[model samples]
Target: MRITRGLADIVIDSLCRGVFAGDCRRLSLRSCFPFLYDAECSKRSVVLGMVAGGDKTPHPDSPLIQRSKKEKWSQWSLRGGMQTLSEALESYIKDKGVEIHKDTPVEALERRADGRWQIKLPDGSVTADHMISAVPAAEMSRLLTPIAKPMASTLREMSASTVAVVNLEYDGEVLPVSGFGHLIPSFEDRAMLGIVYDSLAFPEHNRRSSSSTRLTVMLGGAWFESSVGDPDAVSKETLLSLASEAAATQLGVKEKPRRAIVTLNKSCIPQYTLGHWKRIDHLFSYIHQHSLPLSLIGASYQGVSVNDCIYNAKKAVQRLTGS
Candidate 1:
C-alpha cells in the first residue's frame, strides 16, 4: 500500500466544505488532525488530532468519514479535577496490594543476565519481570538507549509539542459564550491556541467563588516556539499576561482576572507528523525482534486522553497475560 505523505499532499474538499464553503485556501484542512474527510481510516491512526496538532497525521487528506457503528462516543470527567482520577487510581492500586512509588523517576533500564529487567532509580535499582513505559517517546528513548540503541535512536526522532496553560478567575462571566470553550484557528495568528470556559462547562468550578467565571487559557503548541519563544523560558507572568489579553480580546470582556495560574508544560503533546507510522513500525519491529519485555503505551504511540490511556492499558495487560 502507498502511504500518503504530508498534509499538503492530501485533498481537503470532502471534509470541511461546510465550514469553509468556498475558496478552501483560506482554511487549510491540514490545520486539523485526523481530518474526518479521509477515505483510508486505517492508514490514519484513530487519534486525537486536535490536541496534538493536524500536521502530525500520515493521511491528513482522507475523504470524509461517515458515522460508523464501531465508533463509541462519550465524554467523561471527574468532579474535582483530572488529577482526582490519578489519585483515585493510586489509592485503588494500593488497596489492591500494588506498590505505588511516588516521585521516583526511572533513570535507566538494563537487562540482567537472568533475563529480568533492572530499573535504575534515583537512589537505587529494582528488578521487574516485565516493564511498561508510559513516558513520552523521547524520554523512553533515553531509558531504552542502553538496551536498544537503534530503537532508542528512532524513538528520539519522534517529536512532541509543549503547552503553557494560564488559569484565570474573573469577577463575573467574562466570556460571551456559555459552553465548553473555543479553539482558535491558526490563521488567526493568535498566541492562545484555545480557551476553556471552566465554570460554564462544569458548574462545580464556580462554587469556589461567588459567581465568578474560571477560564483555562492554553497557549503554545506546534506554533509556540516560533510565536512566543522557548515554552520553559517563558515566565508565568508573561503567559498570564498573554492569556489575559487574548481572553479579554476574544471574549470582549472588560473584567480583569482576580487571579491567574500559569503552567509551562514542556514536551506535553506528541506530534504525529507526516510519516509517523514508519517510525512506529521500525520501533515495534526492534522491540519484537529482541523479545523485549517492554510494552510501549500512551499518547506518544497510540491515542491521547485519560480514557484512551486506560483503554490502551487494559489492552496491554490482556496482551501480556494472553487473556
Candidate 2:
C-alpha cells in the first residue's frame, strides 16, 4: 500500500528517528528494516510478504526462535543492570578456559604470511588462526587500512551518531505518566530524543528510597553535531541542566534531582544510510575474495540490539566450527 505524504511525515519520520536515531529521508529502508524491504521486493506487497515470510521455516539452531514457538517473547532486564549480563558471560567463559585480556589496547592488526592474524598490543603481540572484530566502524577502518585499503575505505564511509544520557534521581515520584516515557519527533526540534522511565520499568534496580523516581534522558542523535556542537567540549553540568529543563518543560518535573549523572557516548549508534546493504555485501565479497581468516560482527554491520549481537555471534561461531 502506498503511504501518503501526510502519513509518512506524521508516522514514518517519527518512527525512523525514534528507532534508528537518524532521519528517515537519509536512512535506507532495505538496511534499517530489511523485513519490510524484502516483502516489497518479493511479494510486491508488504503485508503479503510478511504473511508469506512468517510461513517460512525458522532456523533450527536459533534458541530465540525456538523459544518463541512455545511462549511469547517479553522484555527483561538483569537484576544488577546490563553489567550483570557481561559479568555472567565472563564467568561462564572463564570456566570454559577462555583467557580474556582486559585493558590491553590493540595497537594494530597484521595478517602474517602464514595466514595467521597477529594482534599488536602495548607489551607484546599475539597470533591467532582467526580474528573477529567487534569494534566501531571508524576504529575498525583505521586498523584495517594498511591491510585492506578498499574495505577500510568503505567502512570509513559509514556514519554514526553520538548520544548523551543524563540520569536523574528525584526524592519523590515525578513522572506524569506511568509507562516507558516518550520520544520526541524530529519535527519537534527538541534537544532530547526521549526519556526512559528507569525506575518505572525496573524498580528493583533503584538504589534510592521506594518513593523516589529515576529518569534517564536521552539527548543527541543525527542532530547532535549540528545542534549541540562538539561532544567532547560539552560539559556534564550543561547536560544536567538540559535534562532538568526538558524534565520541567515536558513532564512538569520541577523538583531538583537528588543525584544526576551525565554520560557522553561518542558515535554509539551507527546510521544505516542508503546503500548500507550494498556496502556490507561488498565488504563480505572482499573478505571472501581475499581468503582472509577474519569475520566482522556487531552493530556496525547489522542489527544493533544486544540480542542481535548475541544471535550474530552464535551464527559466526557455528560457521567457524562448521556446525
Candidate 3:
C-alpha cells in the first residue's frame, strides 16, 4: 500500500491525466501495477481484460501483491480451453471421494437449530458443518442475507463488471501483424477493448489443416455503459458488427469472419476500487466475530485467475479442516 501511495502516486501525479506521454513512464508504472494506472489514463475496460480486476481497484490489493524480484514471468495456455483447468481439478477431487453436485443452484443458506448449516437448493436442502462459497459476491450476499443481514448488505456494495467475449474465425490467415494480440488503450476510443491472437498464440487452436486464424475480441466492461447497450439484451449480430469493424480497421482483415461466437459474462469480475481493503477487513472481522463456519473465496477477494482461485480454495480447505 505504501509503494502504491508513495512511489506510484508520485509518478502518476507528475503526468497529465488520461494522457499517454511515453512508454517508459507507463511501462514503469505497469511494471509495478499493471492494470491500475493504465485504466486511469484510458478506459477501465482495457485493463479489466488483462487482469480480472477493474480500473479503480486498489493497486496494493491487486494480484501484483506479490512483488518479489525472484518472481518469474512465465505463462502457459491450455490446449483445449481454460475450462480444462477446472475439469482436471474436478477429476482429481472426485477421485479423492469428493461428491460434487453439478448444475445445482443454491437457493438459500440458513443456520439450523442443531448448529449446522442448511444449504437449500431447488430440490432439497443439505446440511453441513461448514460451507465454502465460491460464487460471486453478489450471489453470496443474496444467499446469506437472510441469516447475516449486515454482512450481506456490505457484500452487496461490492460492484462487479460484465464482459462480452467475441470469438471470430477467419477462412484463412487474416491478422496483419504477428504475435499474441493487441490491447487498445481506452483513450484510443476503440469499440473493442482488446484482441487476443488465438491462432497466432497457439497454432493448434486452428486444429484443421487449413491455415485459418482465430481471434478473440473482448468487449463491454466499464465501456459497456457507453459502447454496447445492456450486454444481456445486446444481440449477437450487434456485438459482432462492432467487434468485426474494429478488427478490419485495426488488423487489416478484409474477409468477414467465417465463425463468430459471443459469450456474455454478467457480474463476472468484481471491482476492487479505492478503500477496498476496509470492506474486506470488515467482512472477515464479522465472520470471525460471529464464529461463522463459512469461508468465502474466489475472484471476489484475492483474484480472478484460475491459479488464484485454486490457491484460495486450498487455503480455505486448510482453514476449515485445520490440517
lDDT of 2 at 290: 92
For model 1, residues 139-249, the per-residue Cα lDDT tens digits are 998988888999989898877777788888888666777887766655564355777788877776576536788888877676678877886577887888889888878
Looking at model 2, residue 296 earns an lDDT score of 92
- The CA lDDT of each predicted structure is 0.69, 0.84, 0.70
Query: How well does candidate 3 match the true structure in TM-score terms?
Result: 0.77
lDDT of 2 by residue, 133-221 (tens): 88888999999999999999999999998888899999877788898777887777546788888888878787653588899998888
**What residue pairs clash in candidate 1, if any at all?**
37-62, 37-63, 37-64, 38-62, 38-63, 39-62, 39-63, 56-273
Worst 10 residues of 1 by lDDT: 14-23
Number of clashing pairs, model 3? 1
2 or 3: which has the higher TM-score? 2
Every model's TM-score = 0.78, 0.92, 0.77
The positional error of residue 305 in candidate 2, measured at the CA in angstroms, is 0.8
Separate clash counts for every candidate = 8, 0, 1
Residue pairs with clashing backbones, model 3: 57-272
